[model samples]
Target chain A: MTPAIAVRGLVKRYGRRTVVDNVDLTVMPGRVCGFLGPNGSGKTTTLRLICGLLTPDGGSGTCLGEDLIAGRAAIKRQTGYMTQKFGLYEDLSIRENLEFAGDVHGIADLRARVDAALDRLGLAARQHQLAGALSGGWKQRLALAACVLHAPRLLLLDEPTAGVDPKARRDFWDEIHALAATGITVLVSTHYMDEAERCHEIAYIAYGKLLARGSAAEVIAASGLVAWVATGEGADRLAIRLRDAPGVTAAAAFGASLHVCGPDQAALAAAIAPLRGAPGIVWQEAPATLEDVFIHLMRQVPDNAGQG
Target chain B: MRGTLRRMRAIIRKEVLQLRRDRLTFAMMFGLPIMQLVMFGYAIDNDPKALPTALLAADHGTMPRAIVAALGNTGYFAISHSVTSEAEADALLQRGEVQFVVTIPADFTRRVIRHERAQIAVEADATDPTTTGNALAAVEPAVARALARELTGPLAGLAPRAGPVEVVLHRRYNPEGSTRDNVVPGLLAVILTMTMVMMTALAVTREYERGTMENLLAMPIRPIEVMLGKIAPYIAIGSVQVAVVLVAAKLLFDVPMIGSLALLSAATLLFITVNLAIGFTFSTVARNQLQAMQMSFFFLMPSILLSGFAFPFRGMPGWAQLVGEALPATHFLRVVRAVMLKGAGLADIAAELAALLLLLGLVGALALARYRVTLD
Candidate 1:
């Protein structure tokens, strides 16, 4: 089967500086792809370009078998782009917003479709309430419901859960999985590591460049980052010292332990050897984490993301 | 571009629903016209009456008093003071306390009895020629009537025919000199332009301000579809405003409507569309709601001041008239006045209709061109 999304050499330049620089991407149908990147890393711009919400400065590709520029309107009809902000009218009732979405998509039996969406969201009870009155999590869910109101072929969610609670985020992931089960392709950008792990494959970008593209395990192994877990009473405080040391890409405190990773095992051990037996700390070699690989990748890119 | 009708209908319905919920803005759409009509009706007077005058009756005679009484009876002048010297009259005119200074020159009643060519000098303030010209014209006929009443039996043959030339002055259409007749019809154009353009100009900008424009453009709706959908509801609003002003003009003000109602309705729709198009074009240029409001205000100032609504169109300078000619309000004003007061047919106002159609086309094209299809 053909992939739902396939684009190469996609570049977007705002004046002199590039926002999405020569990015290439391909996602198969029914596969949930997590787009992970630091802030100002061109993730949102890439999603906008793919869904035809934005024009690419330089690219040649197809979205759902339609030319990116020529068939933009046609592709837009079949693709749902849920912006980072709640784009639905705030003053409108939840049901009204859904009905408006359905209407714009020219759905038949719009009333029934909206009612069904409301049922799925468990928002039928408060269907008449204004969307602005809902909490952050509920608002996110309503926005999600509106995106899928027309049963779009592709979903481009930009940070679907930024400020949502833990339980709500889990429910949102469950909904994504269910949609993916039905062969609806998903390309969701997020900063959360747990959400990144739930995706079938991951694409990590930084400073307008795609740094990694593979499954979470594949990306971590591909980074070849060496890591050591230091545990005991004072290991958490060692993160502050190891963070600035040579060959130590990331040294983050996770609960009572310090997870330190670097490019080479020899240099990494050399950086942490002096503190190995100091006080009540135990060191053990561990596999590098997805978070460690991402920090390493972010460090690799220069900090000239937005400059010309 | 496909399914444009469905998407446009959806947008229109959504706009109307939002308008219904926003009671204040909805009220403004209709209230602005009536309020402005009533406010300007009592304030503006093209043919000002009861202009203050100081009469220096140096010729203390029965004939001079009768002439002054007749001027007052014409409803044009009020002789408030009888000054003894020309200096006092000059001071009153200079201080702007009086619009006109009437001086019955120091002559005895002997010149009239001897049948000499006697002259009565009346000085007028020439500032604001419209007010002075109409009031001064009434003076001659009033003096003629007063002199005819005075020269009854003995001095009958001496009654001046003014000259061999006889002129019959006619003030057609508005005989009562009612300012409301001009104002009420002009209100239709002014109000439609104010409300239609500003409301729609704010509509698209409001979408952008609230960040919903991205979501909207990401749908199947095209730029033209969005423009038409945003303007459709205001057309109905413009119609309602016209109805209210027309009914009030007939019932409350007793303004005459000498033309066909059908022609007026058609012309009004065209004018309203022109304004909506201009407003939609403004929305494409403005980035936020505040900027939209400022742009609408900038457009509205010239439309009201130069559109022949506040002042006579012909009285303005040639270049200013050129600016007025380019405005939709100027043509709308002419069309409405011709149809409502002059009893003009569609053929009589064809030029104005053509102007409105051209404006609609040009502004509509500009709006379409400026509107962005993608977020880029």
Candidate 2:
């Protein structure tokens, strides 16, 4: 099967600082790929480049078999890009926003498509409500509905569920999976680990560099990091003690438990040896979580900020 | 009170910092005053001189020649066109190419020598009454002085105190010299310029401010499609405004609509589109709605002041008139006045109409070129 997004050596720079540096990303058709990255790590920029909303300063590729630069208009027609921010007309009613999106895409049977989208979103009764008046979750759902109204082949969602409630995020992810089942490719950027895990695969980026790309299990297994969880009285207090310890990459408190991870099994074991025998604390070896793997990956790459 | 003072001081400092960062607003603050001072001081002239006059001397006699020279010497009328026929002179006056048409009769010198009350017809284009008012007053005195020199040798008594030549000053089109007749038509141009440019600028910029421009650009729609779609509604709004002003002009001001309403509508539509294109161009340059509004006002100040809407077009200095000539409002004012006051046909106001069309093309192209298809 042809890859939906096949971009190589893509470089985007603002002034002297390269935002997406020599990046290569490819996602096969009908695959839901979660784009994971820290803030300002060029996740949004990379998505914009693929969807033809931005022209790369260097390198070239194809989106949905169309040249990224030359066939931008054609790519735009078949690609749906949901921006990180709400990008619909707030003053416009829910129905009107959908209709506008449909009209811009030159969708046939626009009225029926808008009505069906409204009904599917459970917004048919509130179709006349101003988009600005809706809650964050509802607004996001409406934005999703609008972007997908044209039945685009590829959906580039930039933090589509950033501020949404968990229930709404789950529903949105379910809808994304459903779209993927229908042969629609989705590349969704997100901060939520669970959302990243829901993807068929995830690409982790740090400082404009893609550090890891694989399924959740594959990424975790390949991280080469050791993790130890401790749950007992005053166990959460151990996070502060292990945070800056040599060879300890990340130490964080999760409820009454402390999760610590670092690369190199012997060094991590040596770093945590002093706290292993603390009274009323039970320490057990655990497989590194996606968060642990990402934290390890982030620390491996030097920060690119203010270097340009 | 001390706490309040410290808090107020912090707020004041914050406001100053923000104002400094908004460079466009900062520039306008200083730039607007300087511009206003320069425009008002150097450009505006109520009593305009060098009014273009066409001398149609049927009799090229010494006295007629002397009278034309005297008219030129008044520092009022500039005899730019020397036409031989009456029809040619009428066309010049009708087209607003020349302000006054001076006609010396075939029997002018013969009548003056015979003391037969020789008549010199000075027909002024009186659409702008203020422009021609002072110039008209100087005609009879200037004629008497010229004839006094000519009637020296043979007939000294023929040069009477009231002047040997009878100056028949006919204010054509607006014979009554009513201020409302001139102002009402020009007001339509001003009203449309203010609203259409401002409204369209804000409309396009609002999308940017609201973050909808990104979504709009991401869509499959072309830049021209977006531009025309944004401009189309304003054209309808402009037409409604035109109707309102035209009805008001007729009913309240009793302004004459001598030309065809259909022709006026077509020209007004063209003018509206040009302003909308200008607004779109401004929107592409401005970052937000406030900047759009400021840019609109920047264009509007000169438009209202220099377009002959408020002051006489001929009254302004050469450089200012050149600046005014480039503006769409200036050409529209000429077209509207010619059509409404003079009952001018398409051929008569064709140049101004073409000027407006050229403005629309240039501004529309600029807007399209400046409109970014990508965020880059």
Task: State which candidate has the highest TM-score.
Answer: 1
Tens digit of lDDT per residue, candidate 1, span B1-376?
5578888988999999889988999889878987987886667778888988888887878988888899999898988777888888899888888888888766736677788766777888888788798889888889889989998799998786667887786878887777889888898878888898899999989999999998998888878788888999999988999999899888888888999999999999999899999999999999998999999999999999999998889989999999999999999999999999999998999999999999888988898999998888
DockQ of each: 0.79, 0.24
Worst 10 residues of 1 chain B by lDDT: B104-113
**lDDT for each candidate structure:** 0.90, 0.86
Over A196-270, each residue of candidate 1 has an lDDT whose tens digit, in order, gives 999999999998899899999999999999999999998899999999999999999999999999999999999
* Reference-based TM-score of each model: 0.94, 0.78
**lDDT value, residue A87 of candidate 1:** 95
Q: Which stretches of candidate 2 lie over 4 Å from their true place?
A: B1-161
Interface RMSD of each: 0.9, 15.2
> Best-fitting candidate, measured by DockQ?
1
| Model 1 stretches with alpha carbons more than 4 Å out | B55-60, B81-133, B152-158
- Candidate 2 reaches a DockQ of 0.24
Give candidate 1's whole-model lDDT. Answer: 0.90
**Model 2: clashing residue pairs?**
none
